[model samples]
Target: MVINENLKNEIEERERLERLYQNLVEKMPAVSYVMNLEKEFSFTFVSPQIQVLTGWDPKDWIDIEDFRLKCIHPEDVHEFVEALKRSIKNHEPFHHEYRLIHRNGDVVWVEDFASPLLNGNNMVESYQGVILDITNRKKAEAELIYNAYHDVLTGLVNRAYLVERLNQILSRRHPFSEQPLFSLLFMDLDRFKIINDSLGHRIGDQLLIEAAHRLQNNLFPTSTLARFGGDEFVILVEGEDPRRDAVQLADQILLDFQSPFLLDGKTLFTTISLGLVIDNGEYTEPDEVLRDADIAMYRAKARGRACYEVFSKPLLDQVINRHQIEALLRDALKRNEFNLYYQPIVALKDGRVVGFEALIRWITPQHGLIQPSEFISLAEETGLIHQIDRWVMHEACRQVQQWYQYGLSSFPFTVSVNLSGSLLHQGNVVQMISEILAETGISPQSLKIELTESVFLETSPSVNQQIQNIRDLGIQLQIDDFGTGYSSLSYLQRFPITAIKIDRSFISRIDAQYSGTEIVQAIITLAKELGLEIIAEGIETVSQLHWLKEAGCDYGQGYLLYRPMDAESTEKLLRNIGKGDEVM
Candidate 1:
């Protein structure tokens, strides 16, 4: 009786333990699996959760031969098999992540882990493992990768990818590869900023997307296309003959943008400038390729956009020169290397000096006597023009004050200073000029503001308002280097323009052929009709002066009348003029 009770109790306890194990296996999220290695790699036991995880019943794993292999992604099968074998051979634990084709044909990623079940000899026995669904994690990883390499707006490869791929190509090429050359075309869309400023960014984004599609469509299958951010794109063209291909590709790109883009009903027209560099196997860094291509792109833009330029040493030299100028210009004021020279603006009727134009000159310790033509543009680009403009205005005013203090104020001659177009954008421009005149104790009439015709073409209402404020302040407004720009006579009617300085280009072309004579006559006629003054620049010859006088030109200035001189020389000339004597 005692023995029977013991056996019955033991059997019940075993049954309860078995039920607990089954419950654990069924409740777990992962599919628990056991394999028999002595025989073929086959499943001996699999959790019922296999159905929930991979849509396969537990029985299917055991009944079907090589069921896992059949479901394993083809690309990962070898790695999966090798991992299991390695774990069993070494009698150690193992882990791997690989792909599996689900019963519904959707790709599923699984994190597989296995523990080798070895005998006393530590030889092959079997592997017990679990596979947890990691498809969501894999999807997250892929999304991160895509975002890292591609632009979100256009769905094109971004600059990061361009740098990576460019470096890869350059690394694989060696002397034995004969050149293994490629071409990089750097493209920048012209007038894109205007579009962004005029239309909304939403429309601009749409235009960019369409432009990207156009560029990607034109590339060869082997090539790579990437966006360098902000209306700039770079292409890597791979071919045995990359030079010819680059030219053809650039030409095609120009043609592509030639047609207007219709975006949400508005037809917008735009053009692109291309800078191309045919790789000669000399570059080791990716940025060098990009830098050279960028240099060329600017050259294309300089030649007027909708054109292409190939990388050259001279372009690099020009870029270096620009950098030097920018660096020097930034420190020019601080070092007191800047000086002002005055060129007299003469009245054609009596050759009497009516006013003087302040021309800035930089006398650098390293590079002597740098003219405005060499560095003024750089100053404007670097925002140094405002500082320089303020200095010239104050200095000219002070010099005029000095002339008055020294009895050299000849009939209250006015001093004209050219204002950079950038300054007109300043909301405080009128106030700034007002403060400068007030601080110097100079009358506004003695200080004239000179601007290029390009200034009148500015569409800014604020700028026009600013000009009106200057005129209201009793300061004279004149257009310097006129006839070279595209402003119309209507500007004279619109702005408070007191005079127009005809560009030297028109004056220099006067000859027996009467070149530019008609243009001059037209300008003089337009000025006369509007009751505006006209001053001819670059009057190097008597014939030019004679012709200008005959054409009713009111004022002139150049090497012929008076070269740009220092303040002392100009004061002397002013005294001479005060005495009713012409210096010439």
Candidate 2:
């Protein structure tokens, strides 16, 4: 039949719209479907995505009854069916998530949204729905949740998770009623970092994992052990008699560590220090209790490790004091609280001043004055000695430069500054010295670095090489308090030593004690043979100085000639010496 032009155009328009809708459905990534309301969930239409999403062909599902509902996970089927019922009966849209079993036998998370399709009479006729695969998103969310409470390296509950567990236990009014009187013990390995550094980190990691496993196996059956980070572990025990139990456990732990751990064909020995606290009647916050345990652990280390200690108030107080001092020291370098005092080194033959040793003194405004013995050791303990050493070098260099400007002295003389073992062992010691020299414009020959015996013992070959390299830069190396140490004559032959200072212990009794005189003589003879200059220290009397001069000591320093004085006093004393005052 021939149709009117207007009717023909309308038919073509409707056909074009239907083709567009089909193309959109076929190309969509999500599965789309329509079902009727006769309890017959036939796929009246299905997108091509259905095959990829569910491994089922569109034609296969075309006449299938309730195929989608059958595919829903057994666990989520009730929820899914109830939502579908509400959507159909109330004529409202519904959204839900369920696990879908695909034809490949794999379960996946899928989000479904459906709306009740209505006839022109406003009555529900069918349902149209879309399904989105959200398996990857669900997996990602699960991982994030898991990682939030677990340590990634060890796969153990982290500190945050531990705190949460503690809170859960504490929130209960009867935690100790049947759960057994619980206790938490913190464990730290002694000198663990030395193992990490001397050996590589790989070995250190293996050692830590082995330690964790040992703790797990040997600990009480109900105990939970966790890695608290490098070399630290926490053990939670649920039992009675916690005090005696903790000590016994610590002893067993030490015994287990006594056996050599064979790793990469090497036998390594390790020990641990433990801090334990019983959760008897006293109530304490988790963090506060952990802090007290940490303090006790340090006390264990101080008392010669491989032991355990219970928390005490006095130990915590000491920890607080140490922290306060450390905090103050961090700013002390910037506050200009430190100064250098010079003790003159004199030529015994002519009684003329040759050089000086720069000693550090702290001038705290609040504390009045602090001795080097007090803060210097503290600095070493807190790893602040490197900064303090650098400051001393700069100040000593500046003072020598000042003396040069004064022209009181004809030429720049060696001003010795002490070097801490920590500074010497650092890999960048040579580079630091070179940089400081370049920055200060001080002649390297005029600066002397005094090292003690412990410095040599702690330093590696790389460090020893660095020391030799710096010495080659024209700076002198002097071993201070030489006779006091395992003072070996062999180091003189091995090291490029320029000078040695006889310890005051030998010098103070040179004339009174025969053995002291023999030690002084032997040291002087050795210094001459080794071509190393000798300086006798702590010559407090004229008789001692006379004896030292008779012993052919090249230089001597003591309270007899001059005590350590400020730069101004040192300059004045030197000026007096230039004028030949009180020289016999």
Candidate 3:
């Protein structure tokens, strides 16, 4: 056959194009290479950038495929080979980042992206790939991931990462094969807040770090310990019966804290409450398990701290009930499940209405007439108290405004609402109250705010700011159940409070014992000295009432005066009292 001019010209152009492509590959930033599938150490093409990235010349890689494999970090080589095998078998693209050993004896991160090149017959002919140096990006990513998953104070895995790891291990591909028995051990350091109070959080943090190191040393090598925020930790144990191993682990952990932690030359001691639960084998998801474990941990704390409890069905039931209540509360405002009942706060001397305390009642559709004591703390713990508090303020204010409009304007009755610690912590309590008062056209002076001593103790400076804001709005603040708390005179001055109510416990026993009488008198005298108004609670008997009146108590609230009643009954009772039909 004679050679055609057109065929010869086409060959020359193809050769030129091949040379241009090779030049472009050589100029690329990333190293480019091709290796034959049949050869163990064969490189058909190697880019010149290999010298710049790996300190290996292109001549050193060509025809030596094993050289690249030898340069792969030893720990990552097996996974890399397996990935390649998988890509080839599936005829798919592969991408992975791994450490590489450079010729300068330094480790560099590289991301390999390759695809199985197939022949026309649909067979994997070889792998065509690019290698990119992603060391700087990987370093940044690793730092971010570390910060995200670790607690800055103790250098322990945080709650988010703990949950992530738990989810990963509890998946269907769980590492444990012996029936996949695993345990989640939740630990909480006892009296941790006391440490922070006494020594400050700076020392508290050092103590936590020391405690973490001690606990970490005590855990089994396979066990994973995570700091689940604050002084809490969650340990995940695989391939062991939780009842046996968890108890032993808990015992060992308890021993770890036996030695005192010396921080700032001060010997500090802390104990832990542990709650462990075995995998129920019912395939209950990870979140539920963690929640139950946490509930059980709280139960352990309630059962006189520093003890371990194995989670039981009862704990699960309690958690489920709490969860139901939380869900109900989330929708309670929209469903109008809350109503306020006003209990009369009367002047003991005149036996006349002076103010009213607004108490919240939950009128749930499924569970009717839920008591405030039962769900009030639940609201605080679940972060629903802020909403509940706002609702009570608005509703109570609205009621007071309605009563004024209904021609009961001369009652001289102030509506006092209770403030929970959660609400105080919101930092917007004052703003919320101002908004409610503005919306309801109720005078801030008529909206008295009452808080328990525990609320004051737990309230931060932000909460103090909120209280100040409320006070600036002309609202009065009263510390309820005052004598029941360990409050100092100095701390009392820190708050701009208008009143303090002697706890019912002190007054209930005023008739029962001399100590109670003396304590009640001391509380009244103390309140008067502080220039604070006094309210005596639980005045049931005439003798008790007379004693409180003599003690200079300004107000009284109890079943003796009148039990809490519905709005209609309260109005009827007030009318009857005005007509001298009832003694109250």
Candidate 4:
């Protein structure tokens, strides 16, 4: 009777433990299952959560033949089957993430984990596994990856992706005798900044989107297009004749841009400048190819927009030379290699010196006596012009102040300094000028500021106010190379300009044979009507001088009147003038 009671207690304990195990399986978030290895990995048992997780009854999992394999996404089925077979054959645990097709035809991502079930003899019997739905996590990961490689505004590949693809192509070795495997085109919209500044960024962004669509639609299906940031784009082209294909595409793009872009109810016109570089066995890195393509693109811009240029050895050499020059220019200012040369402005009526224009000259230790034409534009491009301009202003003012103290001239002669458009656009330009005058103790009236007509093309309210402020400081303002740029007559009346210097191209053709005489005469008449002083530049001949005097031009300056001279020579000339000697 005691043994019978003990057996009854053991049966009760086993039933209680079975009930507890069933409750835990029902409550777990994952679907737990057991597969029979002897029966082609068929399910032997499945938790109740299987129905809630996959919208299928738990009994169907055990009754169906190869239902699990059939439910896996077609793209992931092979990988899933191979992983499962490896795990079963090796008697090891299985861990894999794959997509499954739900009953409703939706893709459900799952993470599957399984371990080999062992029998009493420690031999593998069946596989015990759990499936956890991870669809949201996989979607989040996919979105993150997409955002990393795409441009937010244009919805195109970004620079990172472009470089990555380029690296991949460059890694493959190709024969030197055959044509390149691909071509790279680096292009940018010409005058995009004008549109952005005038119409605002909203319009600019819309235009970029439209441009991206047009470029994509025009290309072959195999081509890859990417937005390289801020109105710049890159394209990778592959074909039997990539060079020819690239050129045709570039031409088509240029032709397409001739059609106006209608953005925000405004019709705008723009052009593209493109650079083409074909793959050669010479380049082993992506940057080298990109650098060459960029160099070619700038060359197209230099040739005027709406064009394309191909990369060549000569172009690469030019770029290298420019880089070397830029490097030298960075140290030129610190080494005191810059000097100012003064060219005298003569009174057309009396042939007497009235003022001098201070011009910058770079005297390098390696290349002696470099002209402004050789380095001024480079300086402006590299933003070193501001430093050079400031130095010239202070040095010229200080020298003129010393000349006054020495009584080198009997009359009040002005010194004019050429200011770049970049300097004129500075917010602190007025304050900088005021400080220079105060430090040098030079009279503001005797220091004239000369600006090119290009500075007036994009003038804003703040820029106008800055000009007025500079004028209020008692400094005179003159427009240099007046007729060479896109300045209108209204600019003269609107700005605080006191004088206009007719461009040299007009003065050089002022002889009786050319129609340039009429242009110069018209300029002089217009200046007189506006009550502005007119100075004729590049008056190299006697006939040009005679014509200027006849036309009532106020001042003239060129090689004929005086060449640019060093400070010591200028001082001697000033002394000679103070003594009433004929120096001109």
After superposition, the stretches of candidate 3 with alpha carbons farther than 4 Å from their true spots are 1-154, 158-183, 187-223, 228-232, 237-275, 278-285, 297-310, 381-384, 401-411, 424-428, 438-441, 460-462, 483-486, 505-522, 539-552, 580-584
What TM-score fits each model? 0.89, 0.60, 0.63, 0.89
Which has the greatest lDDT? 4
Error of 1 at 240 (Å): 1.7
- Per-model lDDT: 0.86, 0.80, 0.80, 0.88
Q: What is the per-residue lDDT of model 2 for residues 489-525, given as tens digits with 9 covering 90 to 100?
A: 6678887889999999888886643335888899899
* lDDT, candidate 4, 1-584, per-residue tens: 99999999999999999999989989999889998877665689999987877788887888888877777899998998899878867878999999978788888999999999888977788888899999999999989999999999989998889888888877776655566878999999987876786568999999999999999988976689999899999998986888788988999999999899998789888889999998877877889988999999998987867999999999989878788889999999899998889999999999899989998888898878777876888888789999989999999999999999998869999999998777766688998898999999999999999988867766656677888998999999999998887658888898888999999998888665544688888888999999999999998988888888987999999998999999999999998898889545
Q: What is the lDDT of residue 321 in candidate 3?
A: 85
TM-score of candidate 2 relative to the true fold: 0.60
Better of 1 and 3 by lDDT: 1
Provide the clash count, candidate 3: 1
